[model samples]
Target chain A: MKIEVTSQMTGNVWKVVVAKGEQVEEDQEILILESMKMEIPVVSPDDGTIIELKVEEGDFVSEGDVIAILEED
Target chain B: MTKQVVEEQNELKQKIDKLLEKKEKYREMGGQKYIDAQHEKNKLTARERINLLLDEGSFKEMGILAHHQNLHPTMEGKFTPADGVVAGRGTIDGREVCVAAHDYTVLAGAIGKVAETKVARVREWSLKNRVPMIWLVDSAGVRVQESIGSLFAGNGRQFFDQVQMSGVVPLICALMGPGIAGTAYLPALADFVPMVKKTSYMALGGPHLVRSVVGEDVDEQTLGGSRVHTQESGVADLEVKSDEECLKVIKKYLSYFPSNNEQKPPIKEGVERAEITINERLAEIVPTNPKKIYNMYDVIKELSDDNDILAMKPKWAKNIITAFGRVGGYPVGFIANQPMHLGGALDGDAADKAARFMNICDSFNIPLVFLQDIPGFIVGSKVEKAGIIRHGAKMLHMVSEATVPKITIIIRKAYGAGYFVMNGRQFDPDYIAAWPTAEISVMGAEGASSILYHKQIRKAEDSKAAWSEYADQFRNLIDVEVAASNMLIDDVIDPRETKLQIFDAVASAWNKKVERPWKKNSIRPV
Candidate 1:
């Protein structure tokens, strides 16, 4: 299954934790967002390989923006 | 004895034998072929479900011989055994409960007038006896063939009766199969609704009706499947993989709830003794750094007895978690903010979820435990247009109106209105506590600094440096000790001692009582 991890809040990408094609476990931080003066991590929804990292570090993403795509195990 | 007396006794015996044979035939349930088909679909027969749910040899079947009374020429030879419903009183875990299992093998489990009467009778028994009402819904809605005319207006008394039963008794509805149109409402008004993964669905209109009425083509699963309801719509509570698991989940759910609102939840006395032990994992589970994320379930596990937390609407509103678990063997509803999603912030959906769960807990006399790591409700124009104010108000209303014992734990950030809705000190939490890492403030220090010292920073030679300096000072002042000194909270405790502190408080408030000035009811926020 393919899952799109979307941003729950509008924020700047503090850092990209995983690269494209990297294997990540469920809840593994794929990226971090700086929002509301808090560093919120966007975690993988399931154990999967990250097919795409849509945002880069320092990029501003709005709420509902796709952060990454995962191909689930 | 005379030959005439012997013949008369033989005749009575034959009549009794015939009645038993008729019941045996109805038990076949649309014969072997349909039963096999149901099994192939990974579903259980109505009788099988009832058998699995109730105690051994405890089912007292009712209306087993019931059949439809529709006299239309098209239905002249139709045979609908039990009128497509298997209903009776049975005991589950030694407690009596009324069950109505829709038999999908018969007439596709289309509900007819007779079957409705049978279900209504069971519902009456449930209400009159103050026992829990369980509905194994697998119906294809009303029998449209029999009521193809204008008499549908007089029907729908079931939902009205359900509303009356709500809050008074635990009304549990499990969707084991398709629940189309009117049947979908069974779970809507229910206190607990669990749907079978692939086999069950609930929609206001089935595919056929939907296509013709609105001219949109869609399948039943896509429209109202377990995923759609449990994840997207928040209509169902839990989605189980199979029929057996669904029934087991129901039994487990009932264990946490009293049969009726007049009683307190059942306790596992053995588990109570082990609840107060301080688990070192609790300290490791939560991060002292507010920005660093941690799973709230980890924290919940350390507090719950046996680490068993039956979460409700877990997939939807992922920001908030509404779950039933035991602390000190006493059933409690834990409403915690999930930092993994939305930085543990409360939004419209999160507030709605918490509000509804609060009503359920408060109504059933279950003590509530608030795990506050909230950054407060979501702000900005997008949420305002989504009616966040009114939706957020529901939580405030429920938290204030909830008369049950409330225990608040400010683990990290308890800022803004989130504190109030999450049972802040003003909300009358019986024993409110904060941890050493707790930051109880009106707002985040950074945001408050920017607003409060906007002029000071503007006048400073280096505005950015001045702002940071001011923000650092404000951040230090937002500590738990300030609240402690002001006596705003009960006490600040070590993170490792959370389980013991909560358990002792819950045990003490077991016999809590609250009296309110009587009114019909307060008009709560929608």
Candidate 2:
């Protein structure tokens, strides 16, 4: 199953923790966003392999923006 | 003299025999052929379903001999046993409940003139007696041939009765077969509807009517099947595989409610399988990092009695959690935020869901426990267009109007208007406590600081670094201790002590009563 990881808040992507094709566990932090001067981690909702990374470091994304796509194991 | 007496006894015997024969016919239920067909369709007869729903031998039927009064030549000989409905008062798990099951065997369970009257009568009885009403809806809509003029026009009383009984008593429905047109409204008004998979269907019109009116071709299942109602439309609360399972679900749902709103929910003896202890894990379960997400369910479970909680609408509007669980073996309703979803923001749907749950709990006199981890109500033009203002106001209205003892524990992130809606100090919750991790703020520190020091931060050589430093300083200002010092909250306590604190608060307010200014009721925002 393919899952879309969406940002819950508008923020600047501070770091991209996983690259495409990298396996990640549920609740694993896939990226950190700097919003309101706080570092907010966007975690994977399920254990999956990252099929696509939609955002890069320093990218500004709005709420509900898809940041990554994961293919569940 | 003896001969005359014997003759009178013989006459009485004959009359008694006739009455017994009539009852046998009523029990026959559309004869063996129709019953066999019902079995073939994997559906139970109406009485059989009621038998499974209620305690055995407890159903005292009301209108057993009622039949269609339509005396037209075509309908003259038609045998409408029990008027195609079996309604009565029964005990489920030894608690009184009123039930009406539409019998599919007789005229395909059509809601004829008499059947509608029978249902309406039972609804009235249930409402007056203040007992929960369980409707086993499986009707083929109004009997079109017999329902004309007065019969068709007077059919609306049933729906009216349903609306009247809305908050007065719990209404539960199980769709065991097709319920089209007029019959569809019963389940729609029900507080909980469990649809039987495959056999159960509900729609405003059947395939034939739809085809005739809209020129659309569709099958019954395709139009209003169990899957469609439960998943696509969310009209039904659950989809069970069989009639038996549907009844079981109804029984379980009723366990959470009292027989009526006037009484407390039935207590489960020795329900606390585990001793109430402060789990140290709760202290660390909430992350110190403000922006990190944590599973709120874990914290709820740790505090709930025996770690047992029944979450309602778990999939819908999941940012806020609404559930029924026991705290210290006393039934309490829980409203919490799931930071895992939407960063625990209150969106339109979340507000509606929580507000409705609060209303239910308040109406039933269930104590409410608010676990605050909300950031704020979602902001944006999209949400405004979605009517978040009115919906969010509904939540506030319910919380403020609720008469039941309310205990609030701010685990984390009580920010902006979310704080007030979640039973903050302004709402006058009976007891309000906050964990050390709670951040009582107007907004997140970063956003607030940027607005306050906009010019200064913009003028800094490294504006980003300057903004972060200012945000950190503002964040430290609104910690739980600061709020407690200002008397904005009751106290800042350890997370592990939450269970005990809430239990004590609820116990102290167990007999607390409020006297409101005499009025019909306050009109809540939609």
TM-score of each: 0.95, 0.84
lDDT of 2 at B460: 99
Q: Can you tell me the DockQ of model 1? A: 0.61
- Global CA lDDT computed for model 2: 0.85
Q: Give lDDT tens digits, candidate 2, residues B403-462.
A: 899999998889999999999899979999898778889998888999999999999999
Among all windows of 10 consecutive residues in model 1 chain B, the one with the lowest summed lDDT is B269-278
lDDT of 1 by residue, B431-506 (tens): 9999898989999887889999999999999999999999999998887988888999989998989988888888
Where does candidate 1 stray beyond 4 Å?
A1-4, A13-32, A43-59, A68-73, B272-275
Candidate of highest TM-score: 1
Q: Give residue B5's error in model 2 in angstroms.
A: 3.8
> Considering chain A alone, what is the TM-score of candidate 1?
0.96
Which residue pairs in model 1 clash with each other?
Answer: none
Q: Give the Cα lDDT of each candidate.
A: 0.91, 0.85
Q: Give the docking tier of candidate 2.
A: incorrect
Place model 1 in a CAPRI quality band.
medium
